[model samples]
Target: MKLLLLNLIFLSGSAAAVELNADGILNSLIDEFVSCVNDSAGPIHQAAMRLFWLLVPINLVISGIRCVFNGDFSDFFFSLVTSVLFTGIFYYLLSHDYAIGKSIIDSFVTMVDDDYMGPSELIDLVFNIDRQINNLMTSNVLGLVSKLQIVICMIVFSVVMFFVILRFVSIYLTAQILCVIGVFVLGFGGLKATRYLAVNYLKLLISKGLELITVLIITKTGCRILNDVIDATKLYEEGLSVLKHSECMVMIFISLFIFVLSKSLPPVMSSLMSGTSGGFETGLGLSLKKYRFLISRNSGK
Candidate 1:
């Protein structure tokens, strides 16, 4: 009987060790995959950036020609200088690896760390829960309902992370593509349509930057609130057997918030960028309307 008990104990310990090793290997593989993707993408990004700069001189010449035709040397010179300056600034940012999307993500991460609600904490919390579940499984203490809840939470967490990461990558890639194409097209000053396209593209770049920041802010704020609730629940858990239920509620709330933010943030960002309330529309519309009225009056005179 003693020998049988010893054998069982040894087998259990070995099984647990194997499981942990498997998890570690899986995590390492994921890290390597992400690194590989970043390395592969670097050259493509650089090429797009280079092409954008190459088109700047062409755009300047076209703008100069258009201005000369309009008999507006001052406007031509002003546009030339401003366009060059903006292009230079963008070039500096791109060359120095200060990509707007990456910068916003890093800044938000830093802010969350300062507020004691970093993503690392969330990751650790999830892993800890996973560990607990594993232990329960080994000890035969995990009920069917408890196992289901754990599985559901894990699935939800994975889905949220996957979609969030996908959206972020899409936004970053789109911004890069737009910056290249938009700057190149801005050279075609003779086409009124191209000019409008260029302006809209510029607005789009700004919108992308704003959208990233807004999403990060919302996510971080949500995480912080969730963390606070979690901490409060821990205090209450000492006197009650409601920890699992509390955690379930918290996880559900987090998942819902993430879904809502992902679905709603883009539209809010677009509206903000449109300047419907003291933005580009209000200023530009009023200015253009007044300019047209003045032109009509002058023509009548």
Candidate 2:
């Protein structure tokens, strides 16, 4: 009897532990994921910072010589001061683990809440929506056509969200890397190369800023729409009518609109950066063209 009682006690303890584990699983997972990313990025950031510091002196010497040859003493002095300030500021920020990418991510998380749902949470929500629709259809709670439409809407929403997440991550990483390496490349390269590199880097920075803003807008809007859908589901569970045909259609249209924007925005950003938009040139491109035109006109005179 004592052995049987001990076994029962063990089973009860195990059940309680399982319940606790399940309750904390999502938070645990998120914490570990963030920790892993920080750990992995730390070494790369350090190496990049070191390389940048090493290149700074060499770049400044070259730039100084070129400026003197061009009779631009004032330009050389300005560049020197700016370079020193930029390096010091970035070094301090990087040493404290406060990269621009991390700042952007933190801003996004805070924009929602402490309990912001990431891509994984979004995927789970999609799955739940699909499952709920399936159950409703199987129970004859909704018409077949209506159920199918809702299912399709869920799928499209999931696909668009997935693509958005993928694109955002890619752009964030690319921008961070470019910003890190761009200074060295522009500084070491000749006058023409420096001019081009500066233009490109500026364009990239602007594009990245725009992408983050777009992400913020979409995330806030999508979350609000999702919450409404979730509330509707709760009402339906309470025996209220929900998932009307018109609602399903609207959801599908919204998802498609988001998908189109996600796919199209990046290309438009690229075109703008390259100054390839029909008849609309970026300031950098126009400035370069004007500079060349003036130089040629002076040479002819």
The regions of model 2 sitting more than 4 angstroms off are 1-46, 60-101, 104-124, 144-157, 165-206, 234-248, 265-301
Per-residue lDDT, model 2, residue 157, is: 67
- Counted clashes in each candidate structure: 1, 0
Q: Which ten residues in a row have the lowest lDDT in candidate 1?
A: 1-10
Q: Residue 225 of candidate 1: its Cα lDDT?
A: 59
Per-residue alpha-carbon lDDT of candidate 2 for residues 78-168, written as tens digits (9 for 90 to 100): 5565556545644554454435545554463456544565444554555566666666666666533565576677777666665655554
**TM-scores for candidates 1 onward, in order:** 0.51, 0.55
What lDDT does the true structure give each of the candidates?
Answer: 0.52, 0.54
Segments of candidate 1 deviating more than 4 angstroms: 1-125, 132-145, 176-193, 225-250, 275-301
lDDT of 2: 0.54
| lDDT (tens digit, per residue) of candidate 1 on 194-286 | 334445545667777666556556556656655565565444334443336456556667766765776688668856666733434236546
Clashing pairs in 1: 275-279
